[model samples]
Target: MSTIQKDSAITLHFTIKLNDGSVADSTHNMGKPAKLIIGDGSLSDNFEQCLIGLTSGENKSIELKAQDAFGMPNPDNVHYMDRAKFVGDAEVEVGTVMAFSGPDGAEIPGIITDIAGDSVTVDFNHPLAGQDVTFDVEILSVE
Candidate 1:
């Protein structure tokens, strides 16, 4: 049985739940295990640390603070864009999420929070930011 190490590629079923016990994300429901290499920056450092020595068929449940999980929300991530930006095919209703092009041409998801006569409030913070979370992981394999 191989233990997770610095560069270990592992497959695991995981679920992230908020402090209120509401699931934020889960791989088990999709019937597909997630595969990732440790220390690859795909997962947060605190999250990777929780799997440092686990072997195949092992399971762990860890609780993480808001900062450790998704970091606190930054006010600067909230922006008010001109309502004209959504005139075309973009939806303008509140609670709608749209992806805007970033500086490097990457898609940045922003959720519409409010819509006034000429302005639309968009929040770019990750939905789970500022909330403590619990991670339930079942290690299936380590390579």
Candidate 2:
């Protein structure tokens, strides 16, 4: 039974829930476990810290503050792009999620929170930002 530590490869099933007990994300719903290596950039350091020392078959519900989970939303992350930038049938309506190219060629997903006249407000903040969250994790394996 290996404990989760730096550089350890881990497989786990987890769900992210909000303070209201509303689920934000869940691998359980997807019917698949998530696999990741510790120290990888896939998860925030604060999130990964909660998994330390957990062995196989262990489960825990770890609560995190807004800043610790996803951090408070940054006003700078909200940008108003020209409606024309949406192109044909790109779904620019409010609540639509779209992917935009990042500086390093990564696909950054943004949500359209508002549409006003010729401006479409796209928020690049993580959807759960500014909300406290709980991680319900079931450790499947650790290596």
Candidate 3:
């Protein structure tokens, strides 16, 4: 009978839906739950706030704004890289997702925004950036 609080290990089945009620992601379909350590950096503070008071076997839905969700897309996040970088056989087509090294040594997954002549434009922004999303959570366990 543990309560969900900061530093709690929470297990939940969740479905992320858009404002239009379109399912973006769902763990319920997989028949397995996901666990998140409260206060972890994996989730934003706003997202964590929504789960702070939930108990086991609870169901809740929370709405998140663009900023509170994936955050607003920054113009600077979009970059144009040399086409030579993509020497592999994978089609360098627009809308393709690729991973590139970031300044912090993390692989930043970027979307191929454009491909012209010798320059292949890549956007390093999160795919869901600037999008307002909703989280539909079913608290499977809280400890």
lDDT per residue as tens, model 1, 24-75: 9999789899999999989889989999999999999999999999989999
lDDT of each: 0.93, 0.93, 0.89
RMSD of each: 1.2, 1.1, 1.5
lDDT of 2 by residue, 1-143 (tens): 79999999999999999889989899989999999999998888888899889999999999999998899999999998998888976766899999999889999999999999999999999999999999999999999
Clashes of each: 0, 0, 0
Sort the predicted structures by TM-score, highest score first.
Answer: 2, 1, 3
Clashing pairs in 2: none
Cα error of candidate 2 at position 52, Å: 0.9
Q: How well does candidate 2 match the true structure, expressed as C-alpha RMSD?
A: 1.1
Q: Candidates' TM-scores?
A: 0.94, 0.95, 0.91
- Residue-level lDDT tens digits of model 3 in 27-124: 97787889989998878899998999889988898999989888999999999889888987778999999888888999889999999999998988
Highest TM-score among the candidates is held by which one?
2
If candidate 3 were superposed on the true structure by all CA atoms, what would the RMSD be?
Answer: 1.5
